[model samples]
Each structure stands twice: as structure tokens, then as C-alpha cells.
Target: MRIAVTGSSGLIGSALVRSLLRDRHEVVRLVRRPSRAEDEVEWDPKRQYVDAAGLAGCDAVVHLAGAGVGDHRWTEAYKKEIRDSRVLGTAAVAEAVASLGTPPRVLLCGSAIGYYGDTGERAIDESAPPGDGFLADVCQEWEAAAAPAVEAGIRTVHARTGLVVSQKGGAWGRLFPVFKLGLGGRLGSGRQYWSFISLADQVAALRHILVTEELTGPVNLTAPEPVTNREVTAVMGKVLHRPTLMTVPPPALRVALGEFAQDALSSQRVIPRKLLDSGFAFEHPTVEDAVRAALRP
Candidate 1:
């Protein structure tokens, strides 16, 4: 299949690109700068422009370009950056594909489990309605931005991703070194449930969604079983052979992360109902399994 992918340099995107290439699938990388290679296409999400000709004849488009939510302290400006990056970038990709004479068969727009904000211990799935919070609002807008492609009769799927369990990047990337140094511990009361998936499963799920014709709406990319922050701490310590003796208080987290701390400490017990129902299998099904996969060379 010929797939055009944005955010090809990101944690999940990079891995997905590698997997697709390994399978001999042609990949066109959408970059913000000038196209430097035959597989490169220039796009400007800020202006909502994509080189339609570059997208022509592609079988699918995986739009994943967005600002890192945890990359900075949540100042009001940085929050806006997060929202604009996802919403605008998705709109650009959607519009471009819709304008193509023959639109891509599938449009997988990146989303997050944050859409079901602070679900506490209650496990949720794709059937759940949008929750309340900054991220939930942003996710709704982000997914809606892909309407152009959907309205054009294209198969649009919103991949509501979870906390990726990989040392290569994302929140887990920062946790590995801290845990290895024996500074790892639970955050706050450590009771918040964290829905997570291994990097390998994440990429595979994206590809599954791309090929699964019946999947057209929101599909979670999380594991079947979700673990709490305390459980994750234990697994990290056990897998890394480190001591989990420290505890980060909620107050300290608030001071350290600002508004983002609320999200960090939020509990979301999400399940991959759609993925499982669609016959997608997870390479790492448990927190321990994910930690071990992340430790692989």
C-alpha cells in the first residue's frame, strides 16, 4: 500500500514508518519544510495547505503531526499550541485528501485517550461520550477537523491513543532514566489508572486500522488491561531492578507541571474494545510486558 504519513519523525510515527517500509509499503512523508527526497511532500498546517498532487494516488494517510502535550509546562500559550497543532494539521491533511481526484481509502487521524478525561476507575471504550477538560475539548476539535475527508466518502478513523510504553520517546522516555537512577516512585496517591500500550502494539494497531474496512470511527489503541500508577511503579522497579522508594506529591506535581499536572495525575481506565473486536492482537498485554519490551535493545 502507498501511505502518506505526517509526523513521520515522532515516537509512534517513526516506528510506524519503519514497520511500513519493512513490509515494502511505499511511504510519503509530509514535512513542514521543503521536500528533500522523492518520498517527501511539503505542507504548512498553519496555513492549512498540503500539496494535493503529492497526495494523489495514495492508498491511505496517517496524520499524526502535533505538538507534544507534555513537552512544556502548560502555560496558556503552550496549551493553545497543542490544540492548534493537532486541529490545524488534521484539517490540512483532510482537505488535501478530499480534494484529490481519487481520495485515499482511509484517513487515520491521531487522537488521545484524554478525550475521556478523568474516567477514574471506570473502564471506557469507543462508545463513551466525550468527557470534560482541556484535552477532551481539543480532541473533539481535532477529530472533527477531519470532516472534510469523511464528508467526501473517505474512511476516517480517529485513533485515540494512550500513554505509549516506550523508552524511545513520550512520557515513558523520561521515566526510564529517572527509574534507573532509583528516583522512581508513584505520583500523588498513585491510584490513578493509566491506560497504556507498548510501542510495538501502537504501530501495529495503526496499521490494523488502516486496513480494517469496518473501522470508521473512534478506535482506542490502548491495551486490554489498564494498570494504576502504583502498579506501573512496581513494574518499573521490578523490570529495571531499581528501588521504588520515592513519592511525588500532588502539590509538587502542580508546581512542576502547572495545569498539565491535572492531566498527569488523571485516571483513565481505557480498553481497546474496537481493536480486539477487529481481531488485532497486542504484542505486550500487561504493564510488565510493556516495560520489558521498552527495555529491549
Candidate 2:
């Protein structure tokens, strides 16, 4: 199968590319800047224009291009960039893929568990309605922008991911040094629910969705048991053999992260109902196990 991957340079995208290559599938990248290169399609998401001819023979398209929700301070411009990156990038890819002579069998779209908003201690699943907020709104529109592809007879699947725990990128990488220094601690009101999954599990879930014909729409890419923030800190401290005696107060979080402080302090107990129902098995079912694997070099 020929797989066209967008955001091929990103954390999840890079891992997905490697996985697909290992499976010996022909992979094409949906790049922001296009040039005469092998298996690369240039499409400008900012301008919302993707050359249809560039994706003429695609068998599947996995869209992972987006601005990091927690990567920037919530300035007015940064907010717009976050919203536009996902909405526009997805729209362009959907349009291009929809125009293909042989459209891909599946359009694996990217979304986040933030779609359910901050659910507190409530257990949310794919059946739960969407939440309202910055990230939620962005994810809603991001998933909605691909309606054209779905309407055009292509199977569209939204992978609503939770906190993807990895050693090299995202949150884990940023916290490793602090943990090593014995400075790692829980955030404000560590009782807040945190839904997370291992990086290896993320890749496995993606492959599962790609192969499962019956799976489509919003699929929560979270672990079965959602742990609290305090539990997470305890497990990390245990695994790394460090003591988490300090705490990051809410005021400090608000000062350091601006509005995204809510993201860190909020809760979302998302479950992988669709994935498990679709026969997808998780390699690391708990945060401690995932962390141990991630910390292993």
C-alpha cells in the first residue's frame, strides 16, 4: 500500500513514517514546501492549495500536520496559528486527496482528546460530546474540515490522541532533565485525571486504524485506565527512583504557561473504546510500564 504522510518531520509523523517503511509500504510525504524530490508532494496549507496531480495515485493519506497546542504562549497570533494550522492543513489535504484519480482507501486524520474538553473525573469515550475551549474548538474544526473527503466516499478516521509519552519528544523529553535533577513534581491539584498512552502504543493504534475497515470517526487513543496527575507523579518518581516532594502551584502555572495552564491542570478521562472494540491491543497499558520502556534508551 502507498501511504502519503503529512507532517512527516514531526514526532508522531516521523515515527509513523519509520513504521510504514518497515512494513515495506511505498510512502509519500505531504510537505509544506514542495520541490522535485522522490515521493514528496508540496502543498501550502497557509494558502489552502494542494495540487491534485501531486497525489494522483495515493492509496491512503495520514494527516498529522498541525501547530502544537501547548508549544506556544496563547498570544492572539499564536492562537490563530494553532487553529489555522490544523484546519487549513487538513482542508488542503482533504481536498487534494479527494481529487485523486484513485483516492486513498482511508484518510487517517489527527485530532486530540482535547476534543472532549476538560471532563474532570468523568470517564469520556468516543460517544461523549465535544467540549468547548481553545483546543477543543481547534480539534472540532480540524476534524470537520475533512468532511469533503468523507463525503467523496473515502473512509475518514480521526485519531483523538491523549498525552503521548515518549522519551525523545513532547513532554517527556522536556521533563527528563528535571526528573534527573530530582526537581520533578506534580502540578496543581494533582488529583486531576490524565489520559496518556505510550509512544509505541500510538504507532500501533495508527496501524490498527489503517487496517480496520470498520473503524472510522473519532477514536480515543488513550489507555484503558486513566490515572490522576498525582498517580502519574508517583509512578514516574517510582520508576525513575526520584522523590517528588514539591508541587507546581496553579498560580505559577498561570504565570508560566498563560491560558494553557488550564491544559496542564485540567482533566480528561478518555478511554480507548473504539480501538479495543475494533480488536486493537495495547503494548503498554499503564503509565509506569510505558515510562520504563521509554526510559530504556
Candidate 3:
């Protein structure tokens, strides 16, 4: 299979690219930067243009191009960046795909569990109604932005991901130093439910979607079990052989992350119903086991 992947340099994208390459599939990257050697293709998403001819023969396109959600402060300005990067980039990719004389069969675009917003202790799945808040709105629009491809008779799978965990980078890398120094603990009230997935499971789930013709629309790329903030802290503590003695309250996060603090503090109990029903196996189903596998340094 010849796969066209955007955001091929980021944490998840890079890993997925490697996995696809290992399977002897040709991987072409749709880069915002200049295309390098081989099957690389250049695209200017902000201007909303792509070389239709370049993407003509690809079997699938895994669209992961977007701004880092947790990278910038959630101010009005940064929020626009978040929205534009996803909505615009996704629209651009879909448009490009639509314009293709022979479009790809499958499109695995990135979405998030944030689409369910803060569900408190209530377990939400693909059947649940859309929730509120900034992240939720962004996620809603992000997935909606892929309508063109779906309308064009393509199998579009929205990978509604959760807190993607990896030891090499992402949310875990920032905590490694603190946990290694025995200073880690729960965030906010510590009871907020956290929906997370290890990098291995995330990539595998994506691969599963690429081949599964029956699956489409908001596939939760998360583990079977979702944990609380306290659970995550305990898991990390157990992995590092340290005691989670202190708790960082919500106010502290507010001070540290501004408006974005509420996002981390929000309780989102999301489940992988679609994936499970469709028979996607998770390598790390428990947060503790996933943490141990990731924190193996």
C-alpha cells in the first residue's frame, strides 16, 4: 500500500510512518515544509492548495497535520491557531483528496476524545452527544472539516485520540524529570478521569482502521480502561518507586497554564466502544501497565 501521511515528523506521525515502512509499504509525506527526496509531497495548507496529481495513486491518506494542542497557552490567539491548524489543514487535505481524479479509498484523519468534553464520571462513547468547552468545539469542527472526502464516497475514519503517551516525548517526557527526582503527584483534584493511550496502541489502532472497511466516524483510539488523575499519579509513582505525597490543586494549574488549566482539570471518561466492537486489540489496556512499558528508562 502506498500511504500519504501528513504531520509525518511529529510524535505519533513519525512512529506511524516507521511502522508503515517496516511493513514494506511505501510512505509518502505531505509536508508543510519543502518536499525532500523520494515520495515526499509539498503542500501549503494555509493557502489551501495541494498538487492533485501528486496524490493521485495513493491507497490511503493519514491526515495528522495540526498545531500542538498543549504546546501553547490557550489564549484567544493561541486558540485560533489551534482551530485554524486543524480546520484549515484538514479542509485543505480533504479538498485535495476530493479534487483527485482517483481519490484514496481510506482517510484516517485525527480527532480527539475532547469531542466528548468534560463528561464528569459519565462514560461516553461514539453514540454520545457532543459536549462543551474550547477543546470540544475545536474537535467538533476538526472532524466536520473532513466532510468533503466523506461526501466523495471515501471511507473516512476519525481517530478520536486521547492523551497520547510515549516515553520519548509528549506528556510523559515533561514528567520524567520530576518523577525521576521523586517530585511527581496527581494534578488538580486528582479524581478527574483521564483518557490515555500508549504510542504503540495508538499506531496499531490507526493501522487497524486503515484496513477495516466497516469502521468509520469517530473511532476512539484509546485503551479499554480509562483512569483518574490519581490513578495516573499512582501508576507513575509505582513505576518510579516513589510516593505521591503531594497533590497539585486546580488553582495551581490555573496559575501555571492560564485558561488551559481547566482542560486538564476536566473529567472526561471516554471509552473505546467503536474500536472494541470492531475488534481492535490494545497492547496496553491498563494505565499502570502502559506507564511501566513507557517509563522503562
| Worst lDDT 10-window in candidate 1 | 72-81
Cand. 3 TM to true fold: 0.97
Task: Check candidate 2 and list the clashing pairs.
Answer: none
TM-score of each: 0.99, 0.98, 0.97
The Cα error of candidate 2 at residue 223, in Å, is 1.2
User: Which parts of model 3 have CA positions greater than 4 angstroms off?
Assistant: none
The true-versus-predicted C-alpha distance at residue 176 of model 2, in Å, is 2.1
Q: CA lDDT of 233 in candidate 1?
A: 98
lDDT of 1 by residue, 1-297 (tens): 999999999999999999999999999999998899999999999898898899988999999999999999988999889999999999999999999899999999999999999999898999999999999999999999999999999999999999999888999999999999999999999999999999999998999899899998899999999999999999999998999999999999999989999999999999999999989989899999999998999
Winner by TM-score:
1
Q: What global local distance difference test value does model 1 have?
A: 0.95
Among these predictions, the greatest lDDT belongs to: 1
lDDT winner between candidates 1 and 2? 1
- Each candidate's lDDT (Cα)? 0.95, 0.88, 0.88
Arranged by TM-score, best first: 1, 2, 3
- Give the Cα error of residue 127 in candidate 1, in Å: 0.7
218-292 per-residue lDDT for model 3 (tens digits): 898888899998888888888889877877888888988898888888998889998999888888999887887
Give the per-residue lDDT of model 2 (tens digit) for 269-288.
99899998988889899988
